[model samples]
Target chain A: MEISYRDMITVLHGMGFGVLFMLAFSGAIGVIYATAVVGPHWPRSKWDNAMFRFYLISMAALAWLATISGAYIIYPWYRAVPPAGTADLSTYPRALLLSNPHTAGWHDVGMEWKEHIAWFTPIAMTMVAYVFIKYGPRLALHRQMRNAVLGFTAVAFFSTAVAGLFGAFLNKYAPVRGGPDIVLMREN
Target chain B: MSVEQQPTGSGAAAILAAGMGSLALGVFAFAGDAVPALGRAFTFWQPTGALSGVTITAIAVWLISWFVLSRRWASRDVRLGPVNAAAFAMLAAALLLTFPPVMDALQGK
Candidate 1:
């Protein structure tokens, strides 16, 4: 079946949003697992270590992919419009993707901070995964480094959570998509 | 050393694996956007298609990393602080420089 740009765009957005949610979920698990493994006499299993590292590496990588696809959908809208908060309310009350601001606010300013903040997702997650692996066996031994890793992981996790919130919000409202010379969708 | 004390593989392998994994994601996902020809090159449906691509890449990275890291271990304890740190630093640098915004800035007058 031929897919409209709307379907494709929506699907891509959902893909990124869903994957970001997964990333956050996996990241939370990672931090928990890492924390659990740390401390005296904690049972240490090599395979378990491998499993943890695998989770981190794979999730981080997948996050990058999702973000890339998400950007693919967003970039055109991002560039085609004027700066956020500067849009002409009368002519274009919302950004390119909003038929109206009430329902699908995410298509407008809802996504503004998300678009920019989303950049940090892959960067931070990749680092978090690396730290977990490099210090796989030593995390508990070094308190400061352990805390640092936890902090960074939290940030990455938080970032993914934010992306997910925007996604869920945007998707929930099923907002009208609009842009230069376009009005793909709008809720009455 | 006990099995518990020794991690299954060398830290270096895991480091490289993460980097390779991230790169795989970058190639598969970002290419479609940055280069229109590449995106159109394959008729991948959104979401599902994209998920499949990333899954393949993630599995490949895991297998390759495990194999390489295990082989490198070769019955010795390997503390990966310096080497892994170096690899992580390199990947971070590459990500920083190649990220879209930075790339755009570099190209713009």
Candidate 2:
């Protein structure tokens, strides 16, 4: 209800990351779908092409929502503290569970989900990529699909680049504030 | 090019109906944040409050656009081409940019 500057910035930033995450993830999946999944079993009609396009668009939207719920909240929270190897929060006053690994439970849940999604992201994208590359070129209605793929792929690359830059920025400016190692450790 | 006959009246009616329906629902979804009685009933519609409003408004915008486009290009195979792709990417990018990454940056790794 109350919109502070900080909240505004957070929402805006989260939205950006959410969109970036969706575009990149969808693009990557389109590539995989084209080369892997759809190549051999490519469709043969206009209906099929339309359906595939619909599928990709829907999937992209799903990835956007899922990643937003999982990553934007959890990843940022997890990063609030420095990496475990570099620093320890065990000595802090009241030993806030936000920083404490021993007592907190849900703290790691978000990060775990975030990491889990991150891990599976490439696999899912591969499936999407297959659709784009395979059916994309051969559609009777080639123009729309082709244009979509080109746009999708461009976002895939650009967003990934931007993500890396943001990653680096976090490393320098915010630095990892330590928290429970539940999710990170479990994934590794 | 296969030319499908455009929907002259029924299609326009359908689009209008769908657009208005979506717009109404979206409005209802957000009405709770302001009105106390509606707020109680609809608060559950969106646990997160304002975020739900944003979602409703965004969806309504898209639906309205779709309705207009459908009316304009009814029955004709929508000529989706590179332009659509570029436009979609740009739109997505603009939306993404507004989702400032700094907070996520501060919150988690």
Best by lDDT: 1
TM-score of chain A considered alone, across all candidate predictions? 0.65, 0.34
At residue B11, what lDDT does model 2 achieve? 26
The residue pairs in collision within model 1 are A96-A178, A97-A178, A176-A185
Docking class of 2: incorrect
Candidate 1 lDDT at A138 equals: 63
Q: Write the per-residue lDDT of candidate 1 for residues B1-109, one digit (tens) a residue.
A: 1324435244445444554554454444445434556655532445333333433554466457657765876365555455445545544553443345543445461
Tens-place lDDT digits, model 1, residues A32-92: 4555465622326777778777877776777777676665654443334455676553323
Stretches > 4 Å off in candidate 1: A1-9, A12-43, A77-108, A171-188, B1-109
lDDT of each: 0.52, 0.40
Indicate the TM-score of model 1.
0.48
How far in Å is the alpha carbon of B42 misplaced in model 1? 29
lDDT for residue A162 in candidate 1, whole number 0-100: 71
TM-score of each: 0.48, 0.37
